[model samples]
Target: MIVTKNEAPANISKAIGQENVTPAWARAVTSFPPSDRILSTILTRQAERYGERILLVAGEARWTFAQTAAIAAASAQALIDAGIKPGDRVALMCSNRPEFLQVYLGCAWLGAIAVPINTALRGFQLSHIFRNSRPALLVVEAQFASAIESVEAGVELPPRTWIIGAAAGASDARLSAVALPARGAAAPAGAVRPGDTVAILYTSGTTGPAKGVCCPQAQLFWWGIYSARALGIREGDVLFTTLPLFHTNALNAFYQALLNGCTYVLESKFSASGFWAAARRHDATVGYLLGAMASMLLAQPQSAEDSTHRLRVALGGGVPPQIHGPFRERFGVPLVDGYGSTETNFVFAGRIPPDRPGTMGYLADGIEARIVDENDSALPDGEAGELVLRAGEPFAFATGYFGMPEKTVEAWRNLWFHSGDRVVRDPGGHYRFIDRMKDSIRRRGENVSSWEVEQTIQSHPAVAACAIYPLPSELGEDEVAAAILLEPGQSLDPVDVIRHCEGQIAYFAIPRYVRILSQMPLTENGKIKKGVLRDAGVTADTWDREAAGVKVRR
Candidate 1:
């Protein structure tokens, strides 16, 4: 149904306890002029207001607001020394570390576009990103230098490479490589506007290669404002997250800390066994968790350390509803559910003690939502339809998909960004998520492109045809499954199929269950009927990789 912020239901108004009133946080942040919404300006303002306060912690490295601002200036100077200019793309491939943020803030300081690549990507996927972004220089961690070298023949890489934590013999002879340069003299911040593009983050594609989403400066500014409000962040709060810096969730956490005057703690990665201990060690008050994280934590043996941490709440997007209460009862922390995307801001959120258990809460103040049919006509409140959105503030959402004009036009058709998720708006104005309308599978917090997986599997010589689809996973997410119709005279084992895909695709994209069929279900045309195969799910005769004790590593 077409629902604007003004047309919100009375029940939702009462549930949220605000009733058309602007939230204090939103009012305070929006009161500033548009010029103040850029990242460089935000950094300066925060440093001025919270000088000497610890702002970031990664491993043993810590930087205060003032120190971070100085580092940003130095980083900007370093990029300029390396021949980077405003609007140039600088690719960065690194894990969760201090340098990731250093380069990100430096890009904002110099008006360059930072392109953060997923470290898990390899082969064709990595090559596609290098070709699409066309970075001027690549700043890569030492361990990942080989991945760039592997794809050197397929695409044109940047002119120079700066290796972090340089190791002997890690440099490639074909490219101009050097150890990461020392900090340059401090440089002045560039004059950037709120509408300027600051980053291009690539998300998994449904029918084609991954597309880079062009995020404007004001969009991330609003991300910090809205996410902080949703998580109930307060000054002096310790924000902790184990999510990788390549994705929006972790990046948003950094802004949440920056805008809220909190301290952000970054860990290298997530481990269910060490989660609580890490939280306790950091004295974290606010935490972040994505798909399957909470379930994995619950699966750990009960311990006294669960309730010992100081974590009051966590931003638990994509967490299962069944474990919400159980987790809170055991850990003394609440998991707030919310909805957002790489191209969108924090659009919907619930309160600490959510009124409804599983539904995505009412729309935020500066956004409008619509539940529409295939023809873009509004549906009834109870009927399910595709959820589309529009932001009220100027430059508050991503401009478009980078270098893909047709995809951008198709996604933003009719002046609204189309979300490919099917949802239903209840009479009381709560929206519940249904299955995805797009052909994508989400596994362990990563979006696995079924089209890409199918392309990789079909490259095998013995495979005549293949279909990839999602199977119900016990951890409240989808698992990849493949159905293959082999060549008439050839026989193949499922393990061999996985072996062929080892370095070609991501480990998570490899199918867990495989089935071989003599004939395949077909549509009226010649295309395979993936819906029929998805309905059949994992059969008793399917070859199970985990059952066979086969493991795929990064």
Candidate 2:
């Protein structure tokens, strides 16, 4: 099922227009392959078909499909030389770079599972993953070695380690020492299958210890195909992302580009001010927006460069409603926000008949999804419920949480992959995201969507980014609390914030305590660490309208 450059995909009809995401078309176009997909095979096919076509670009470095394939093959030999065996987990703890690709694809070449660790994780959090995965080999960026070493006092690190981008240390051999050229044959043909584990990415763990998500080789291929087709990604489209490679978002982008014979542009991190300029420079035709990226882009000084790029559409999930349309109009590029996760990549995206602004698009291909209640009964359309999805084919979804059978069984209860997200499906055949089941807040005997609260407050003129969560109250229920980041050169009084919410939201949903931060503390995956904010509740510097005797009326 590997797509050769410009070759017609099997079972797919002529490409549908942007407006067509119907289940009928999904069934027609997505013919799941009979054989299990292997990433090594896909890369080899792409190289043979595309050859000199540029597939990856970072800074001034541009790698054609042939070159990338070669490096990956050589990288596999390096892993083998390091005694990495098939099925052994090789932990990769590096920032986004060409090297990350080498190791990730290299491991795939050997059927060694790549464990891409979030680079931002430190100390205790970092140790938890090491203890859990227990990878045989650890490939780390030189900068993080000290922090990784610090955790080794109490926990066992991987037995073997390779330092990339090593700064003059006359000690350990750098991975480059054992590297081979890509043209060299490394392993036997068809040594792996699509069902074989390719990667084990650690979850952000909003509520508990991070679990490793087992992503099969086939799942990543499906993600790329789903993303490319859903967003109408053209052959010349250069998929751009500033998200970390450790996350599924970037990996999907990379594979999406390769799967379609397009180029992929990677950046170390996102920059709001220079975003459009960079897009223009790269001739980026498509990109991704996530978390508060869209909001931050809107906050940047409006420039003519916004519309100057070849960039046309951006794919993402969870864009703030108030800015969703405005961002498109202002930048002259449409943003298609979808909803999915590490477990299921891009299950729903912008579909036919166009959804109401703020809705989380319609369903995507190859899956049967539903909104269900606590008892697993399907809820009527427009009723808020948990979103559970099941793939038509096995291994299309993540196998399960790695090594956690109890949790896996619990999550996949009743034979549905529970998403733990609250959403509403429209009778008109669209869907709207409500909130995370775990992140909901109870106030004044009413369940308030923290997502709704955050979106409303984020629309304020001065607010840059925010997280609204429940703060424990002596009265038995939770009180609303907001940890906010103000726009540069903007300021607001806590009283004004309460007043702003007076008519906009439920009276009970208004924040009682406001903690303004220069920047929101984020998880390794760039999601706001609401749990950390909840733990650091109402400091001396926190503004309390109730303590100040400010009256709030319903």
Best by TM-score: 1
lDDT of each: 0.86, 0.74
Over 4 Å off, model 2: 1-32, 167-185, 188-190, 352-354, 439-554
At residue 529, what lDDT does model 2 achieve?
89
Against the true structure, what is each candidate's TM-score? Answer: 0.96, 0.75
Residue pairs with backbone overlap in model 2:
70-182
Residue-by-residue lDDT tens digits, candidate 1, 1-554: 46656223433323435466554345438545777888888888889988999999999899999989999999999999999999999999999989989999999998999999999888878888989999998989988888775563748888888888774335456567777788879889998999999999999999988989999999998898878777777778899999999999999888888877889999999999999999999999999988799999999999867799899889888888897888899998888888888888898887667666555776777898899999988898889999989999988899999999999999988998999999888887777888899999999999998888898899999999999999988887888999999998999999998998888788989999999999899988998988999999778879889889999866
Supply candidate 2's per-residue lDDT for 202: 76
lDDT of 2 by residue, 1-554 (tens): 11001112222223335343333214312433536367777678778878999999976679999988887777888788778889999988888888889889889988899999866555455677888888988888777565564353558767677777764332333223222223355654338888889999876443455678999888888788778766777676788898889989899888888777789999887888878888888888888887467777888887766677887778746565666677878887777767677887777776422345556676665678878889988888768898888877557789888878887898899888888889887665577777667776655334456765786688889999989887876443477899889999999888888887664554666788998898888988999988889888778878887899988764
Evaluated with lDDT, which candidate comes out highest? 1
What is candidate 2's local distance difference test score?
A: 0.74
